[model samples]
Target chain A: MFKRIWGWIQRFSSPKHFYDISGKMIPWFAVSALLLGVYGLYMGLFVAPTDYQQGESYRIIFIHVPAAWMSLFIYMVMAIASAIGLIWQIKLADMVAAASAPIGAWFTFLALVTGSLWGKPMWGAYWVWDARLTSELILLFLYFGYMALQSSIEDQRTADKASGLLAIVGVVNIPIIHYSVEWWNTLHQGATVAKFDKPSMHIDMLIPLLVMAFAAKLFYAAVVLVRARNEVLMRERNRQWVRELVEKI
Target chain B: MLKAFYHLLARDLRLAFRLRHELANPLIFFVLVVSLFPLAVTPNAELLQEMAPGVIWVSALLSVLLSLDRLFKQDYEDGSLDQLMLSPNPLVILVLAKVAAHWLLTGLPLVLIAPLLGLFMYVPAEANGVLMLSLLLGTPVLSLVGAIGVSLTVAVNRGGVLLSLIILPLYIPILIFGANAVDVASDGLSVRGQILFLGAVLAMSISLAPLATAVALRITASR
Candidate 1:
């Protein structure tokens, strides 16, 4: 069973095969993302009732929370892809990891911006040195570091392997960094983050938030697939299949 | 295997001592930068005392980072790193020996000099001992983790800024706990928790970082 599964993986991960299939799969992902995002946004922005405390302003969580989720989620995907590439020498996995970096960085950036936007009216400040907020900033730095390492290396294969190792190292330290920041925050400031608590989010509020998170996932799939397709074309530019495809196009 | 470890450790130590000036540069950078905060920020002793922990830790971290470019570059350039790798002994042990030598050259001095600079920062004299102890436990982790970064980038030309980007975020945990230990000590609170946390991080990095560094060196060598 393991051998067969491995065989299937080897087949699917071939750059040419992935290019052929992912081109066809993008539309499905795009349409699903579109439908879900539209529904989720409408329900979240319009249908969900206003909070008794913050009134209409709290609705920003619909975007902020989902972006925050994707930032962390996409990092995990990048690291896992990098690990697969390192251990198995899967060229496609390396491409996927490389393609995922910029998108993941944007999500992290989005999460930070949207979070601070929400903080403005709620906390009367554009930003706070909250533990989670600080971690997100450090995570952004890690993503930049990974991307920088990838770009600085002139050799593509070496870049992939080196940055892959970095992603794994960063992932391992994320928890430790987060915990220490939390400990440091609390040590100096006594429970200043209490206002972040929401009063047991309403079911109506909860449903759209869940839907938005799922929609964000689908959006990521659609985008990452497109980016991975580009990576495949570039890395395989010298191959016969790529020339043939270019001629056909 | 033990012989290889000791020999490499001794060799690196000897080479480092031979270049007495470069050996002292990062240590001097540490002391100079730590003293700059009072001049740059404020001369108030009360405020300086409060900010001392963070300033000292950040300076130490940066100086360690500045010194890290020397860790693998010479061996790599001379092709001795490949020779070291070709040895029958496990590469991880060799990597650990190099990192230990680096700590001896660069990290141990930071621990020793921190108290003298701690005096400049008006750190509580009692907390000065805690500062040294925290740095003693913490700086080895810095060297170990920094080795992984240096090994990864040893192939890239002018990888200094990129090295900082890769390694500094990873250093945040150690900085927090190491600095916090002294801060807590100064506050007359029990610093046992912070010290223990630093030790835990040190133990983990010692076990894991050498393996990562070995892998990174292999990757660099292959390229």
Candidate 2:
């Protein structure tokens, strides 16, 4: 069984094989993302009751919370891909790590912007150094750093290795950053905005949130796979199969 | 291995002294940046004191960041970095020695000079000690972590800004702990917890950062 599994792994490790497989999987992920997104947004916008306190303004949480979750989640994915790439020198893994950067950065940017919009009505300021907000800002910077480090190096292999080490290092620091921000906020006794979820969170609110979270994850899958396929084509462009496929197109 | 590490450390220190201008730039930047806050922000002593912790920490961070390009660039340029890579001694030890030298030159002086800056900012005399101590514990982590960034970007021409981009986010935890220690001290709170946190960061960075730096160095230097 182990040998058979290892054989499957070896087969999928080839760029051509992985490319063929992912091309087939992308539409499934894309369609699911679209279907789930439409339902989640419709339900979140209309079915969920407005917050008793913040009223209609609270609806932004549907986007803000999921984007925040994706920002962190994408970083973890990048970090793991980086680790696997570094350890095994898997080109696909490196491409995945590279592809995740801009997507992760966009998610971080969306989260920050949506968060500020949410903050304006609640905190009376567009920006506040709340612990969560502060940590998310730092997370955005981490994404920029990863992207910058990758782009600065001219050699792809060296860039992958260097940025992979950084991703691993940055991942280790994330928990530390989160905890310290929490500690600093509490010590300063800054005006703490309560989290989006209250003690009595409704099932109607919960359903859309859970659905949106899945939609976001699915979107990530579709996008990252498409990106990874493009990267694979670029990196394998010199190969016979790639040339033949290109000629056919 | 210990002897080799000592030699590397001593060599870096001697080189730093020989080129005094590079050694002095960060200190001048530190003082200038801290001084700029009062001029740019309010001159009110109370407000300055309130902003002092963050201001000091941020300036210190920028100064360290400004100097990080020097950490590996000079050696990389002179081809000594290749020699270090080829050395029989473990690269981690050598990297750690370089970082220790960095802390000695940049971080130690910053720690010593922080109290006067605190006084200038109207930080109470009681909190000055904590500010200094916090820098003392915190800046080594900066040197160690910054070393990893320098090692990664060392080969890229004019990687100064890119190095900062790669490093500043990683510096957030240290900044939070260091600034909060001073803030807590100014408020007459027991800063034992914050100081301990800074110490913990230093410990963690010391053990881990050099290994990462060494790996990055091998990757960058080989290419």
Candidate 3:
């Protein structure tokens, strides 16, 4: 049974097979992400109760929390794929890792911007030296570094291996960096009142946040598939199957 | 294996000695950076003292980064890297030796001079010892981690900027702990925890970074 599953995965690893499979799957992901996104936004923005403490500005949590989750989630995915690519020499996995970088970066940027907007009213500033915010900023830098390294190398294979190594290294350091920053932040600021609105999450807010997070993940899947398909086409352009597929398209 | 490691370390040190200017550039950069802060920021001793830990640590980190390109590029250029790869000894041992040599040439100098830089920055006299201790524990980790980046990009001409981009994020934890140790000490607080964290990071990097560096070197060199 294991061998059979492994054989299936091996077949799916082929660019042509992956291209066909992803084409069929991408629309499902896109449509689900769209439906979920609309419902989530409506519920999160309109239905959730206003925070008595933070008032309407707290609504930014709907965007900020989900984006931050995606930022971390996407990096985890990228790093795992990178490790697989490195260990197994799987081109498809490398392509997936490469495709994940920009999407992850966008999520990280969204988290930062939305968090800053939330902070202005709550923390009385556009930015704070809070541990969470600082760590998110570092994560953004990591994504940019991965992309920069990828683009600098001319050869696609070399770029994949090098950036994959970097992604793995960055992932390993993320937790340590996050904790160190947290420690440093607390040490420097001895008496700042911690006002991060961590009230008991009601179901109304929880549902939408969870829905939006799922939608963001589905969106990642749809976009990564699209990008991975493009990578496959480029890498396999000279092959007969790809030529046929391109001609058909 | 031990003999081969010694030979590789000795050879790298000899070459570094012969190319004295390359060895001096990063030290010079470190001094220039630390000196510039007084002029660029403020000459106020109190303010400088407060900013001293962060300024010195950042300068040392950047100088280490500035010197990373020389880690593997010369050997790569002169075709000795291929020969090193072909050697019967395990690549990880050889790479570790190279990284050790790199730390001696670059990191060790920074550590030794950090106390002097701290004085120049007007750091509290009590903090100078902590500053030197932090750098001593921290710079080896920089060399070890920086070796991975240097190995990855050794084949690519003019990868210095790319190298910085990739490695700088990985250096943040060390920077945080190292700077904070001195800062805490300057504030007359117990810095034992920060010192312990730096040592842990150093130990972890020493054990793991060489293996990663060896793999990266093999990957970059194979092509």
Candidate 4:
């Protein structure tokens, strides 16, 4: 089992191998993402019952919650990839980490923008220093820092290793950010969907939300794989496989 | 290991003392920036008192950031950083010693001078001790974590702005707790929880930061 996993790591790190495999996977992921996203949106907007207290404004959670979850979720992916890259010196893991940063940043920004739009009607203010909002803002800053570090260094290997270190460090701080912000204020509503017991959300609302979240995950998989393909091409432009592919194209 | 750590630490301290005038820059920056709040915001003592903890803590945070150049730039320029890296001793201990020297020269002075700034901002006398105590606990964490940033960027040309961009986000939690402790203390509330958290963070930074810094230095030096 260990050797198979190790062999998988070896094959995955080969630029041609990753490029070809991810190329095949992208269409599948993209198609699923598009289909699920449309279905989820239709269900959430036209099918889910109106929120009793929050009314229609609460429907924005379909986008906001999934985007917010993706923001944190992608950061975890980046961190884990960074760890793998750093520990085993797998170049593909580093590329994945690098590619995920901007996507993660965009998701965080979407979450914040949609959150504030929701806040305008719900809290009667566009922004608040609430724990969830504040920590999410800090998460955005963490993404920016990661990207900045990646770009400033010229050496690709050094950049990967350096930014990988930074990602691991940022992950360590995420929990600290959450706790500190929570201590500073607590105005945000408590968890609803992630509760271990039956979620407070009605089933009609919950199903679409889960579908949207799954769609977002698939969407990220598609986008990151595309970005990782570009990374592989850039790094391997002079390699034999890339040269042969360029000639064929 | 102990001998190498002590020697490197002593060497950094000695070098810091030789250029004592430069040591005052971050302290001056700290004091100067803190004094600006009254002129810019308001001359109202009550308002100043309200802003005191945040003002002092933020200025101190920036001051520590500005002084981070003192950690590795000089050594890198002189090629002594390579020597330190090549030393037979473990790099983590050497990095820790350099950070201790940095904190002593830069972070420690902020802690020493914080009360004077606190007084200027009308921080009640009761909170002064906590302000100093928080700085004492918080600033070393800054140097430790800041070492990781500096080492990562030390090879980049013009890394000053990038350093702050990358480092400040990491610095947020320390700033939150350190500033809030003073905020809580000024209100005559029990600050035991805040101090404990700061202490916990300090402990974590101490254990982990130097290792990260060492790895970062190796990456940077690989060029």
Candidate 5:
């Protein structure tokens, strides 16, 4: 079974194969993402009871939490895929890393904007140089740097290696950014849900947050597939499979 | 093996010195940048002293970045990089020698001149010793880490700006610690902790960055 799964993974490492597979999955992902997102938002906004402390304004957690999670999660995916590409010389891993950058960058921006929106009503200021917030901002810069570095080089192979090295190096900053709030005395609040003992959030609020997190994952999967398909089409344009596929289209 | 190492180092130094005009630009840029803050903001002695460490550190980081591309560019262009690749000694060691040469010319000058600039910025005379020491331990790491960026981008034309974009994020932790070391020193607090942390980072980067840079250069060179 393990060998079988490894074979499948190895086979799918081909851009043509991966593109064909992910293309079929995108519509299902799109529909599920929309449905789950709507349901999550409704549950978060109306069904969830208002926080005694933060009141209705706390509903922003539905968007804010998912966006924050995707920001960190997408980077981890990018880094891991880059590592696989670097280690195993997997072309599809590189393509995946390439596809994920813009999506990850968008989610990071959303996290920052929505976090600020949530902060305004709760923290009484639009911005603070809090550890979590500052690090998240740096995360955005890292994404932009990754994308910029990739695009600046005209040679696709050189661009892959250069941006891959960068992605690997910048991985160090991710943990530091995540933990800066804990390590330093910053205005950012400490862990509410990520804590070890038990989550501090009430079950009602936590459920919608969890649903939105799933929705964000589905959204990312859907988008990554679509983007990866486009990237595959561009990169494999000279190949027989792409030529055939384009002819069919 | 040692002879080959020193020969490459000496060759690079000669080439760099031959284009002394290009080499001096980053230092001049550093000075110009350092001068700008005092002009843009008040030249109040107290305020200048307060902002001096961050300004000097940031400018030094930029200057280091400015000079970093030359660490590999000429060799890469003239096929001397190929010769180095074909050499018996491990490329990582060769890379370390090149980075050391870069630090000697670029980072070392900044460390030496920092005290003088600190004076102009109204840094107290007593903090000068700590400033020099922190920079001494810190700046080599900057060159070492910055070399990785240069190597990765060496194949791309007009990569200098992209190189900065790629490297600056990695440089932040060092900047934070390096500046904090001076800040603590200026405040007359315990500089020991911050200096130790900066040294730890330097040691870690010194060991790892060259190997990473060598791998990156090999990929670029091979392609």
Candidate 6:
């Protein structure tokens, strides 16, 4: 089974094959993302009970948490994919890495805005140099940096390798950014869900958070597939397959 | 190999010194930036002291960034970099020698002048040790990491602003610890812990940044 799956993965490593396969997956992913997102929102806002501490205002977590998770998660995926492309010379992997950047940056921006909105009511300030928030801000800068590096260079192969090295080096800071709160006496609250022994939050809250996380993963898959297809088309525009495919369309 | 390394380092230093006008630009920028705060804000002594460490650190960071493009730009343009790459010596050693020369020209001067600038912001004498030591340990990391940004963008036209856009975020951790070390010392707290952490970060960056920078140079050179 493992060998068979590996064979399939290798076959799909070609940009042409990946493009065709992702085209078929996009609709299915989109529909499921829409359905799951709606259900997740419904469950989070209405079905979930109000927190004793934050009350109704805590509903922002539904958006904020998922956005934050996606921001970091997408960056990790991009960096890993870029690394694969650099090491394995996989063209499809580079396309995925390049395509995922803008979407990840958008989510990072949303996370910051929503986080600030939440902070105003809870922390009584629009912003503070809290470790988690500051790190997230830095994450936004990292995304911008990656995109800027890729776009500034005209040569495609050069851009990929340069940006790949940067991505790998910048990955060292991610853990430092994430754990800056725990390591220091930061104003940001400590972990609520991810803990050593057990989660600190109640079950009612945990379920919605998990569902939203799953929905976010699905949403990322759907959007990444769509964007990757476009990227492949743009990069492969000079190829014969692209010409034939464009003529067919 | 040793002969080539020393020759490159000595040559870079001599060339940089001959272009003394360019070498002084960042220092003058540092001074000008430090002076701007007093003119813009009210000349309140307490407020100035309060903001001094952050202001001075920020100016130092910007000055270092302003000068970093010079690290590889001249060599890259005059094709000296290609010759260096084709040399018998390893590129990483050449990179290290260049970074050291860059530090001598940029980072060392910043460290020496930091105290004078610190006085402009009303930084007290008591914290001078922290200020000097942090810069001593931290600025090499800045030169090393900034070299990576310089190498990556050196081949591109009009890469200065884009280089800063790529490098400034990466510089935050250094800025945080470097500035915070002084802050802790000024407040009569023990700063040894922070200093040690800064040293560790510096060591890590020194070891890793040159390899990344060498890789980046090869990538840009390939085009």
Candidate lDDT scores, in order, read 0.92, 0.91, 0.91, 0.93, 0.84, 0.85
Poorly placed runs, candidate 1 (over 4 Å) = none
Q: Which residue runs does candidate 5 get wrong by more than 4 Å? A: A1-7, A177-199, B21-23
Per-residue lDDT of candidate 1, residues A39-72 (tens digit): 9999999999989888899899999999999999
Return the DockQ of model 6. 0.60
TM for every model, in the order presented, reads: 0.98, 0.96, 0.98, 0.97, 0.93, 0.94
What DockQ does every candidate get?
A: 0.91, 0.88, 0.79, 0.87, 0.51, 0.60
Ranking by DockQ: 1, 2, 4, 3, 6, 5
In model 5, the clashing pairs are none
lDDT of 4 by residue, B1-223 (tens): 9999999999999998899899899999999999999999998999999899989999999999999998999999999999999999999999999999999999999999988998899999999999999999999999999999999999899999999999999998888888889988999998898899989999999999999999999999998
- Give the deviation of candidate 1 from the true structure as CA RMSD: 1.0
Residue-wise lDDT of candidate 6 within B1-223, one digit each (tens)? Answer: 7777799899999999898899889889999999999989968989988888778889989999999989999999999999988888889899999999999999998899988977887787889888989988988988999999999999989999999988988887777777878877777788897799789888888888898888888888889
Q: Give the TM-score of candidate 1.
A: 0.98
**lDDT of the structure predicted as candidate 4:** 0.93
Give the Å shift of residue B146 in candidate 2: 0.2
Real interface contacts reproduced by model 5, as a fraction: 0.47
For candidate 5 chain B, the 10 contiguous residues with the lowest summed lDDT are: B172-181
User: Which stretch of 10 consecutive residues in model 1 chain A shows the poorest summed lDDT?
Assistant: A189-198
What tens-digit string does per-residue lDDT give for candidate 1 at B138-159? Answer: 9999999999999999988899
**Candidate 2 lDDT by residue in tens digits, B114-193:** 98899889999999999999999999999999999999988888888898888988898888888988988999999998
In the range A112-172, model 2's lDDT, one tens digit per residue, is 9999999999988899888888999999999999999998888888988899899999999
